[model samples]
Target: MKLAIQTSSGDYALGLIDGTGQLVNAISRAPDTAAAKNIGTLYSALMQKAGKETSALTGVMVDLGPGGLSSTRAGVSFANALSYGANLTLTGVSALEATMLDAKRKTDRPILAMRPSPGGACFWAYYEAGHSVASGCEAPDQLFSRLATEGKAFALAGPLRRIGTEALRATAAEQIDIPAADLACFAKTTPILPITNGTLTYLEPITNMDGAHHIAAKDLAS
Candidate 1:
């Protein structure tokens, strides 16, 4: 009874993954308003499908950003509130990390997960040598420039892929876009571990907007 929520894209996703990693019930919708507005509806629908109450959920997981700020906040807020109300543990996983985790399971090649940033820059991260690495913000040109120096075969995932082939071509980085199903599968194996036991301690808020810039590159330095 692990509940997962992801609102990284325009569409919102809600699902319950059983202990065995099987999808018990899932729903996705492109809401007219912000993702926050549809939280209640999505939660209700999932509960109905599962034939259980929110209180019955064992743990809750949320895809914390590298995506839309408002959407990420909304999803995290909703997940936090629900976890508090239902007495479930909370785990915050990076959306990019999850994307790469999904990609790595599918191929042995290095992975590069990209998402659009607020300022027309890109949120990029790399997974290689069994470590997830965060690369700071980069304009289209900077990203490609760095990729040229790295010269690694990589796969891409997330909403940025939908930015169109022309946009990807503009980067001149050799890569492939992965599907969401792949991400969902990756979540099952290396799922975000709970940081809190459904209590005050479990709510680790990511307050700094510039935190990604400070994400140490040492972990991913290979």
Candidate 2:
């Protein structure tokens, strides 16, 4: 069994995935309190619901997000500590990458996985044929303008905000939601890379930017 956690988007979730990459059970809740405090309760409840102990887990996965800074940090920190204490393998998956993986299963068109960012900017990634082509952070107007100019059909994933509606009109984009269960499913196959450097992925920069610059994951030390 593998444990999966997601706290990005200011929502917290814990999932138990069986060896077959199928979700056995899950628990999700809105950010009613600090993730640091709530995660333990969720973890306990999830394991109880699944009728399994931490020792039963062979690995752990977390969604590295550019969504909510405090929430993401709380989740990642918890995941790192749990994996370390339990001597289990740890793997991190970008929410954007997982969204792309989910979209590819339902559509063949190019995909744009987007999440709202701080300072009116947006975190986005473009994928074609199961591979990432381009990604960046920018305001909605600017991003949609670039997409409109490209004139390519895109299937959009993640939350559907007002900007998402405009993206549909501007680029005729299709909206899709990447469910938490699907994220857990995809996470089972994501590469098993331990986050040994005490660094999270592609989040701090996006959430902390001043809306004047864009940063990529590669720009940061792994």
Candidate 3:
């Protein structure tokens, strides 16, 4: 079994998946008890409910994000400690990839996945032919206008849809929400990396987007 954690966006979720990547059980704040502060306790409860133990887990999967800065840091920190102490593999999933995978289920068109960030910036990724073509963080005003000028229709998926403008909606073929169990499924294929490389995606302020690159997971520890 594998353990999946998604705490990006300030909402917490834990999922248990089998070797085949099938979700065996899950707990989320939306339907479960509010247990964010006591994740270790919650994890124990989840394992008990699933009739399993930590020894059964093969790895840990986490959503590395352009998300709530403090929350993302907390989640990744916990995941890193758990995987290291337990001698288990650690896999990281990006917010862009989660949105892209969710959008692909609804349409075959190219996907534009966006996650809103602090200071009026957004983390965006463009995918074509099932591969990521470009990704970066930028102000929505400039990003949307540049995309519009390209004249290519895209299916949109990500947290941005909840707070985006009508003009943003009009630019997409369709928009969909990121699935609640996104990391659980995406984790199956995502490569495992050393605990040293298990870093979270950190989105800096819009002022720094001009020089931004995909930040490494290790950088966040410093």
Per-candidate TM-scores read: 0.80, 0.81, 0.81
Q: Show the lowest summed lDDT stretch of 10 residues, model 1.
A: 212-221
Q: Per-residue error at 32 for model 2, in Å?
A: 1.6
Off by over 4 Å in 3: 30-34, 170-172, 179-181, 195-222
Superposition error at 64 for model 3 (Å): 0.9
**Clashes within 3 Å, all models in order:** 1, 0, 1
Residues 146-204 of candidate 3 have per-residue lDDT tens digits of 77776777777787555476567666556776634265555534443433334532222
List all candidate RMSDs to the true structure. Answer: 3.8, 5.3, 6.2
**Candidate 2 lDDT over residue span 116-202, tens digit each:** 777777778777776666677778677777667667788888765524545445556777865332645455344535534554322
Clashing residue pairs for model 3: 199-217
| Clash number for candidate 1 | 1
Candidate 1: stretches off by over 4 Å = 33-36, 161-167, 170-174, 178-183, 186-199, 202-214, 217-222
Q: What is the lDDT of residue 151 in candidate 3?
A: 72
